[model samples]
Target: MREEYRGEKGTTTTGFDLGRVMWVRKEPSHDGLIVPKAEYEQEREEYKGWIAKEIELRGVPGQLHFKFVRDTMRMNTDGVLMVVDSSDYAMIGDASAILAETIASFGNIPMEVIANKQDRNDAASPQEVASWLGVESATGTCAKDHESAKNALIRLLKKLE
Candidate 1:
């Protein structure tokens, strides 16, 4: 995926806003399967899980927009994984405020913060990011390190569970 940023001209590098909203259909996958209602519901749940996994596997690139983030949270979200750039101290305050507002508006949902870009020389520490975000825990991650990224994701998922 291509990296997109919000430009000063109220435009984004990507044609559309990088934010994404995923919705899971509750309806059965097959119309003529003739399965029991309970069975169909179970299958639908499994399908939703599969879809979520697929999305995670095929990651998208884009900055999160407040509107889009709100819309996505309105869906059947089990948890939220917030990724922050540890090197961008200037944006941290604004981002933290928005995150706090979103959390308050949406109710207390499971959330985990990932302090990314640890490879940068000027990147803030995980503890510093956590403090700035008002989160008790934040996973440290270097995007270039596949193992570190994967481990951080796993830790967040574990917390969600």
Candidate 2:
């Protein structure tokens, strides 16, 4: 699935491989999530081939920084995947605010809210998460379940297309 081509500049060479990158693991705990160091490192290495650059943002300041990063990156992004922890009810308000801001800033770009950790006993349903976030839909996905993750990705990709 790997393909190489010249960029718009003609001189620049670029390549892409169609695949999946699973980076997080859900453990048996209240939080029920674990990011293995080795897996994270592997994910980073895989991403290096697909992404030109990456930026991490947090809080209001990070949100502002995102604007700068977006402008500087100038990448033709097709959509946004907003991931939410289904069990974290406490952060719904903050998550909703961010979702609203992102929707307003992006202006009708395809977006999908993934309610991850669906396997957890205390996990909220996708419908509940969507309602809480004020979104029309949310895809329930358990990261550890390949089928669930694949279905979620398929849904997101469909929206992107």
Residues 111-159 of candidate 1 have per-residue lDDT tens digits of 6688898999999999999988788978888857977765665454445
lDDT of each: 0.61, 0.61
- Candidate 1 positional error at 11, Å: 18
lDDT digits (tens) for residues 1-161 of candidate 2: 87776663324333332122332323222211123344555666644433221212111222433666644432455666778889989878767776777776778988778898999999999999999988889989986787776566545555643
Error of 2 at 14 (Å): 18
Clashing pairs in 2: none
Residue 98 displacement in candidate 2 (angstroms): 1.5
Off by over 4 Å in 2: 1-74
Top candidate, metric TM-score: 1
Q: Stretches of candidate 1 above 4 Å error?
A: 1-66
Q: What is residue 149's positional error in candidate 2, in angstroms?
A: 1.6
